[model samples]
Target: MREPLLRIEGLRTVFRIPGGEFAAVDGVDLEVPRGRTLGVVGESGCGKSVLSLSVMRLVPPPGRVAAGHVWLEGRDLLALPMEQMRQVRGSRVAMIFQEPMTSLNPVHSVGAQIVEAMRAHDPGASAAALKERAIEALRRVRIPAPERRFEEYPHQLSGGMRQRVMIAMALACSPRLLIADEPTTALDVTVQAQILDLLRELQAETGMSIILITHDLGVVAEMADEVAVMYAGRVVERAAARALFEDPQHPYTLGLLGSVPRLDEERERLLAIEGVVPPPFALPKGCRFHPRCPFAIEACRMAPPALEEIAPGHLAACIRAPVEQSVAA
Candidate 1:
């Protein structure tokens, strides 16, 4: 059997708030195979973005990965020195942030940023060579007249164009893994599809593995081979995308699937998962999602359940997975 491209074991990322510390991401374990994409889906603040940042060691101050091992191709990334990790980041792994505008430096032209990224990993590359590669990267992402766009600042481009530039920079290094956190957050539906198609095309060409973090289930269904549904800092359910979506196990997962407006079924209002995700500082004693889970019982409030394999290659954290429902809708 081949080894996983990226594997996370007992990953726990925490943050310090006003009163005390909060475990933004707690005990997450996942594996991404080579040339595959893992879609992490969850409501906002459920630690989806935090998980990606933790993997990259880019969690901003007041927040850090407090525990666990991040293994990439048999090496423990968590144990690597800061300088070594820096070298590993762009050359072996890269990320496309949630918002391109905020992620990009407004002061520098788009071309300059791409060139700088290339130079960081391949410092031997001359300025002329790097610039040519930068322009070629832009062309690769299907940007019109790449030479002109290279000289423009992020603010000058439309949202879609800016996103394309972000993708270009991330792929310029040809890293083995790409962690994209909400890469289509603000784009229109059509543009969203285009960006997704572009990513698929690039992945097909390079055989790169991707960790696509997004709240959009539609995106998950379209892009992911495997999906991990997160709730309150932990993955509540994980399975092949079709299995998880069509035969959801956990209540949270069911609620998420129900909330999506399916064209096959017409409904006046979408079913929503009741209650908001509680702040990590005030997380519930047992299962963090028990408060919002309609089927939660006394046992559920007493102790959190470990993620157990309910079926081959399928896991769910809820003790009462594949919840028993009575007849008659």
Candidate 2:
């Protein structure tokens, strides 16, 4: 078997608050094979974004990676010094943030930003070659009038265009892994489809692994080969995309799927998972999701269930046994 491009084991990220240490991402493990997309899905504040930030070592001040290892192509990223990590960030693993408007520098032209990214990774390359590569990158992302848009600043471009520029910058060095955190959140449905298609095409062309962080199950259905379902700072379930969708083992995962609107089903009322995600500081004992889970039993209140493999390559933390299997079979 080919080695995975990125592997995260027992990853835990914590923030120091006035009260005490609060973990945002707790004991999460994930693996991404080369050229495959792994979708991390959960509601807001479920530590999806925090996990991405932790992977890039960009966790904000007061927040620190408390434990675990982040290995990229066999190199331990967390062990690398700041200078070395900086080199690895754009060259080996690039990230596309949720909002391009906030992510892109307002002062610099998009073209100049791409050129800078190119030069940063390959300082020995000539200016002419960098310019050509920048233009090619834009074109590869299907940014029309690449030459013209190259000179335009972030504000001058549409949301979609700015996103394209962000992707171009990320792919400037053909990084081994791309971390896209809600990359389509700010765009309209049409533009969202376009951007996702472009990303899929680019991934195919370059064979770069992608860690897509989003709450949108629709996007996950379309893009991911594997899926990780997170809840209250922990991964409750994980499996191949089709297997997860067809047989979600965790109650939280079931609730998430139930919430997604289906075209074939017409109902007067929409199904909603009741209650907001609990804050990290006030996490409940046992299963963090038990308070909201309809299937929560007495056992769910006393001890947190360890993540266990229920089937081949399918793991879930829920104590219940394959609830979706009889329904599907």
Off by over 4 Å in 2: 324-329
lDDT of 2 by residue, 81-198 (tens): 9999999989899999889999888999888999998888789999889888999999989999998988889999989988999999998888999999999999999999999999
Give per-residue CA lDDT, model 1, range 79-191, as digits (tens): 99999999889878999976799989999999999999999999999999999999999999999999999999999999899999999999998899999999998889999
TM-score of each: 0.96, 0.96
- Alpha-carbon RMSD, each predicted model: 1.8, 2.1
Score candidate 1 by lDDT: 0.91
Model 1, runs deviating above 4 Å = 325-329
Q: Rate the local accuracy (lDDT) of all candidates.
A: 0.91, 0.92
Score residue 135 of candidate 1 by CA lDDT.
98
Query: Relative to the unseen true structure, what is the C-alpha lDDT of residue 254 in candidate 1, on a scale of 0 to 100?
Result: 83
Evaluate residue 127 in candidate 2 and report its C-alpha lDDT on the 0 to 100 scale. Answer: 85
- Model 1 TM-score on a 0 to 1 scale: 0.96
